[model samples]
Target: MPSVGIEGPVVSRGLDGDGAVEAPPFGNANEIGWYRGGARPGAAGVAVFVGHMDTRAKPAVFYRLGDVRPGEEVTVTRADGRTAVFTVERVETVAKDDFDAQRVYGQHKRGRAEIRLLTCGGAYEPEERSYTGNLVVSGYLTRTGTG
Candidate 1:
């Protein structure tokens, strides 16, 4: 997983659940802590990153995740000192209550590495309510390096 200090920035890792890491507030917008996963940034597999869009009273780090657009470039810097660049292929918003975690977090057959940035989405519920769904930014690995 990726590590961050008080000045921590967003990064990526494997979903294997071995590394001790933290995902800084999305876009450096807040202080909420999230997990960046365990997969090596550029490795051939799915790299999952999860964060809260908002808490009970305050907006969480990933509130603006839905703003990501297709064809946009996403960079995943690995703890091993390698950085991977991915091109966003698709962006989907799924209801938080209706999302199938297995299909969303499950494995993929693509040869290139894929990363999913997830957070809450849709209209916020007022009573017996919470986030309506999730905003997902899916991208395919395009490049990797230190710089």
Candidate 2:
């Protein structure tokens, strides 16, 4: 996402044994974790990516995610040698307690190749060492090309 000042490796990640989506390891704070269990970037379904907004020491790869706005473009380079260009549809900040997995990760419409970028946001809880909400950026595929 060079358009928004985000540049990093995209690591394929899977669910944990408890079925929870895992973030990139602490060692890879600059990496973006792509959910391998969902639709591919250009596929007709929702694809999700997660990254840390900031580490304990400094701002991470997605620190500027919330800076993005609607109508901007997000480009994804797939491992399969293809490029997916998506246009931002919306951006939201949902409280942790109000985080709806289905609504955030679910497909907005049948056969639409959508993508979501998630990161921690809202009030930071120093006691818990985590934020009170998550920032979600929604987009839909607008173009595709061979890499």
Score every model by TM-score. Answer: 0.70, 0.95
Clashes in candidate 2: how many? 0
lDDT computed for candidate 1 = 0.63
Q: 45-112 in candidate 1: lDDT tens per residue?
A: 77777666666666666666666788877776566768788787778888766778767755455576
Model 2 CA deviation exceeding 4 Å by range: none
Q: List the residue pairs that clash in candidate 2.
A: none
Q: Write the per-residue lDDT of candidate 2 for residues 1-147, one digit (tens) a residue.
A: 777899788999998786756789877899999999999899999999999999888889899999999999999999988999999998999998998899989888889999999999899999999999999999999999987
lDDT against true structure, model 2: 0.92
Worst 10 residues of 2 by lDDT: 18-27
Candidate models: Cα lDDT each: 0.63, 0.92
Which lDDT value does model 2 have at 121?
A: 88
